[model samples]
Target: MGRIVRVISKDASVVCSAIDGKDIVSRIEEIHKTSAVVTAALGRLAMGTSLMGFGLKGKDDSITVKMDGDGPTGALICVSDSMGNVKAYVQNPVVELPLNDKGKLDVRGAVGSNGTLSVVKDMGLKEPYCGQVPIVSGEIAEDITNYLAVSEQVPSVCALGVLVNPDLTVNCAGGFLIQLLPFAPESAIDQIEKNINGMESVTKLICGGMTTEAIAMKALEGLEPNVLDDFEVNYRCNCSRERVENALISLGRAELEDLSKDGGTDVECHFCDKKYHFTPEEILGLIKE
Candidate 1:
């Protein structure tokens, strides 16, 4: 299990949320069997999406973050519920590329800058809210930062990192999101900027034995930070055989009739690779219903 913490400045000038998602990312890698570069790219995206989902106010509210880039990784999608349970997958999980000039995993090369980053929020409303922004950088962190600033009108700083071991396992993965509340004082803004500039990458801090609360405090240093709440998060998919059956039932009588003639079929979930098998009798029953 991973941990997530929410912190706020004493003066209420800033709010920051941080997460240590190493375990979550590890589970994702295990399920997706992603290559090194794809692991880093998808890991960062999942962490960022979890942080955003943690801020939802309603119990049933959910968010989906999608990166439709022109890079080799193709489109990456992550869905998170209000409680910070996230499930993510990449279109091309095995795509690999040479490290960039920085001698780091080529996340940018794997997730190209030529596409759009879109977010959809389901808040139990008639119509879900959607936000879209041009991918500022192929790096997932900058793209999220840009989405918040442009689409949400909130000045924010998002930092995400994932360190993959030589054997393609996750070493550490985490991130922090700091947003300036409305009418934030100039002094607090400057201090937050200075603290971020001086701090190391989030993965380094986690690898160095820093917890989510400690990372949150580090981001809000010099501002009298206080932890509001903390909780455990995991890479959980709510998919089940029943849900898959219902989805197949929605395909209408014509589609069900055709499927019933096929003897049997296996349906694989996108988020989790769990397969649900439906026999001809099951399909015929659905068609009759």
Candidate 2:
């Protein structure tokens, strides 16, 4: 499990959500067996969406982050509940790429610069709120900042990163997001800018054994920051046999019969490669509308 900490500046003009998601990211890598580059790419995206999830106000609220880039890794989708529980699907989890010019994992190469990053939030409303922004750098953090600025009209500072081991295991993964409320003063903005420019990297901080609380405090170095709340979340999937059967039933009785004539049904979950098999009679039993 990983922890998320919610912090508010002493003046309440700014708020931040900090996460230490190494454990959850490690679970994702194990489940997907992602290549080193894919591991870093998906790890950063998952951490970003997990922070978004922790920001939801409603208990049933959820958020989905989607990216379709012009790279070998294709599309990446991640879903998270209000509590920060998250699951993700990678279209190409085995993509291999050389290090970038700076000797860092080429996340931008795996996720090309051409595409869009879309965020949809279901706040238990009639329709979810949707926002989209063109991918600025395909480096997760920059794209998140662009989306918040252009689509939501919120001036935000975001830092997301993942450290991957040579064997493709995740060494550490985490992110922090801070937003300036409308009432934020000029001095506050200046202070934040200075702190952000002076702070250590989020991945470096996490790898050095900093907790989510410490990271949030570090981000709010100049401002009077207070820890408002904290909670833990993990990587988990909600797929089940009943859901698989319902999916088969949605295909129509004629199609079910046609498929049953050949063999049974094999349903596999994309988020967590859990497989479910049904016999011919079982597929026939799913004839209900």
- What is the C-alpha RMSD, rounded to one decimal, of candidate 1? 1.0
lDDT of candidates 1 onward, in order = 0.94, 0.90
Query: What is the clash tally of candidate 1?
Result: 0
State the displacement of the C-alpha of residue 276, model 2, in Å, after optimal TM-score superposition. Answer: 1.6
Q: Using TM-score, give the best candidate's number.
A: 1
Worst 10 residues of 2 by lDDT: 258-267
The local lDDT score (0 to 100) that residue 178 gets in candidate 2 is: 91
Off by over 4 Å in 2: none
Report clash pairs, candidate 2. none
lDDT of 1 at 289: 44
lDDT score of model 1?
Answer: 0.94
User: TM-score for model 2?
Assistant: 0.96
Q: What's each prediction's TM-score?
A: 0.98, 0.96
lDDT tens string, model 1, 30-122? 999999999999999999999999999999999999999999999999999998889998999998788899999999999998999999999
Residues 118-234, candidate 2: write the lDDT tens digits. 999999888999998899999998899889999998899989989999877889999999988999999989988898998889988889899999888878877889999899889
- After superposition, candidate 1 runs with Cα above 4 Å error: none
